[model samples]
Target: MQFQTFSSPHTDRPNSVDKVMLQVILALLPGVLAMTWYFGPGVLINIVIATLSAVAFEALVLKLRKRPVMPTLHDLSAVVTAILFAIAVPPLLPWWLTVIGMAFAIIMVKQLYGGLGYNPFNPAMAAYVLLLISWPIPMTSWLPPAVLSTNPLDFMQIVSAIFTGSPPTGLEWDAITMATPLDGMRTNLDQGQMISEISQSPVWGDFGGLGWEWVGNWFLMGGLWLIYKRTITWHIPLAFFAGLTGLAMITFLFDPESYPFALFHVFSGGAILGAFFIATDPVTACTTRKGQLIYGVAIGMLVYIIRTWGGYPDAVAFAVLLLNMAAPTIDYYTRPQVFGHGDNHG
Candidate 1:
C-alpha cells in the first residue's frame, strides 16, 4: 500500500484587508462626530461628497483598466482615503473642489500607481496638497469653532455656502471664516511675532484652539484603540511623538520666547492623527521595526521643521509623502537578518 500525503488544516482568522479598513473607518467616527458638532453640517456634506466621488472614480478607473471592480470597491480603501481627505480639507470649500480632489486621489494617486499596495504616496495627503495648491482661498477658509462662532451654520446654509460660495441668508463667507491655530501661528511668526505672544492670542487656548484640542484628543484615543486592537503597531506613533517632542523641547530650551513648548507641538494641528493613523498606513510606510522608527522620526522632524521654518503651517502631508518616497530604501536597510544567516564582521 502507498503512503498517503498528509495536509495540515487551514488556519481560520476573521482578519482581511477590508476588515482592517472598516475598523479604521469606525475608529474615525468619534473624530468625525466631534468635527461635525463643532464645525457644523458642512463637514458632513464634505464627507459625503468626497466619499462618493472617490468610490465612483475608483470604480471608473478599475473598469477602464479592465480589472474586477466589485472586489476592489468592497475593500473600502477608497472610502477611507476619501474620508481622510475630507477631514483634512476645509469643510466650507466648494463642492467641486472636493470632487476634484477625491477624483485625483482615487484615479491618479491610488489607481494609476496600480492601486492600494502599489501606491508610493498617501492618497489623502496627495489629494489635500493638490487642493491646497489649486485653491488657496477656499482651502484656508476654515470656520471658527462652534464655541467661538456668533452664528453657527445650519445644514441647508452649509450646502448653500459650499455650492454657491455664500450662505442662504447672504452672509459673507469671510465673516464666519477664521484662520486656524496653525495658520495663525504661521502668519504671526512670519510677521516677526514671538511664540509667547502668539500663544497668548485669543486664537489659542491653554492647550490649543477652542474645540480642536478635544478633537485631537479624541483621535488620539481612537489611535490607542487601534493599537490595542493590533491593527497597527506602536513603533511609528511612539517614535513620531518622541521626535516631535524632542525637537520642540530642544528649541524651547534654547529660545523659549521664539519656540512653542513640546506639549503644544504634540497637541496641535494634525500631529495626533498623523502619528497614529497616517504614518501607520501599512501600504506606503516602512515594514520593518527599525525602519518604522526611523521613518516616523524622520516624518516628525520634517513636520517640526516645516511648521517652524517652512512656509506651510502644518507639514504632516508633505512629511508623510517625502518619507513615503524613502520607505522602500528604509525597509531594505533596516530588515533583520534571517536566523540561519551568518553575521559578517567587517
Candidate 2:
C-alpha cells in the first residue's frame, strides 16, 4: 500500500499578515479622526500624500528586489507604515518633506532592511527622527487647535501651506502655530518657570493639555479595543504606562515645581500612541510575554529620560527605536523553555 505524506493536523494560525496590518489601520482610525478634527485639514492632506507615497515606494522596491509585488501590496503593511509616519509628522510640513520622509521610510528603512519582519527599527519612527534632525523648525511647527486658529485652513489652504510654506491667502502656519504641551513644558522649564505656573496657561487643562488629553484618551480607547479584539496583549501597554508613571511620579515628587505631573506625561505627546501601537509592533518588538513587558518598560523609561533631559520635547520615536534595538536580547532571555527539555542549570 502506497502511503502519502501527511502534514500536521494543525495548520499555521489562520491570521494572515494582511489581517494583522488591517486591524492596526482600523485601530488607528479614532486617533486619526481626533487629530484631524483638532488640527485641521492639513493632517488629512498629509495622510493622503504619505499613504500614496508609501505604496508607490513599496511597489518600486519590490519590483527591483524581484519580490512578488501584488501579495505584499495587498498586505497593507506599507499603508499602515505610511499612516503612522504621516501622523507623527507636523501637520504643516511641506509636501516634498512628506514625500521624502515616506520614501526613506519605505525604501531605506523598511524594504532595504529586508522588508517588514526583518527591519530592526520602526520605519515610521526612523523617518520621523530623520526629519526632525534635518528640519527642526518645520518638524515642530504645530498649529493651535482649530478653536484657537484665527483663520482655520480649508482643504486648499492646507494644501497651499503644505506645498508652499504659506496658506492660500498668504497666512503662514507660524501665525497660528502654538507650542505643544511637551514643548511648552520644556520651554517653561528652561526659562526657570514652575510646572504649576505653566499649568495655568490656556494650553493646559485638568489632566493634560486641552486638545492633547482628548486625543490621547481616544488613542487609549482604540488601544483597549485592540486588546479586546485579541490583536495585542495588555502586558506591553500596561507596563509602558506604569514605567512612564513611575518615573514621572518620582520626578514630580522630588520637585513638583520643575516637573509636570505623571498624568501629564501619560497624556501628552505621543506617549499613548507609543505605548499601544508602536511598542506592540509584533515584528519589531519582543515576542514573549515577559520580554514584551520588559521591552515596554524600557521604552517608557527611555521616553521619560529623553523628554526630561534630552533635546527633544517628545521622545517616542527615540524611545521606541532604543527598545527595538533590545528586542532580540529581551526575547532570548525571556523565552520559555521547551516542555520536555530538562533544566540546563547544574
- True lDDT of residue 174, candidate 1: 68
| Tens digits of lDDT, candidate 2, 1-346 | 4444467754545538899888889989999999998998788789999999999999999999999999889989889888888888879889999999998899998999899899998989999999999999889989887766777767776777888876567555567687888998899889989877888887787878778888898888889999998989999999998889999999999998998889999888999998889889888899999999999888888889999999998999998998889999999999998887867756
Q: What is the C-alpha lDDT of each candidate?
A: 0.88, 0.88
RMSD, one per candidate, in order? 3.4, 2.8
Taking all chains together, each candidate's TM-score versus the true structure is: 0.94, 0.94
Model 2 error, position 247 (Å)? 0.5
Model 1: CA > 4 A from native: 1-10, 167-169, 343-346
* Clashing residue pairs in candidate 1 (N, C-alpha, C atoms within 3 angstroms): none
Alpha carbon RMSD to native, model 2: 2.8
lDDT by residue (1-346, candidate 1, tens digit) is 4444455544454439999999999888888898898888888899999999999999899899999999999999999998888888888989999999998888888898999999999999999899878788888899998988987777778888899876558577767899988888768777899987787766677767778888898898889999999999999999999888889899989998778888787777889989988999999999999999999999999999988888778788999999999999999999999887767755
Backbone clash count for every predicted candidate, in the order shown: 0, 0
Runs of candidate 2 with Cα error greater than 4 angstroms are: 1-15, 167-170, 344-346
> Which residue window of length 10 is worst by lDDT in model 1?
1-10
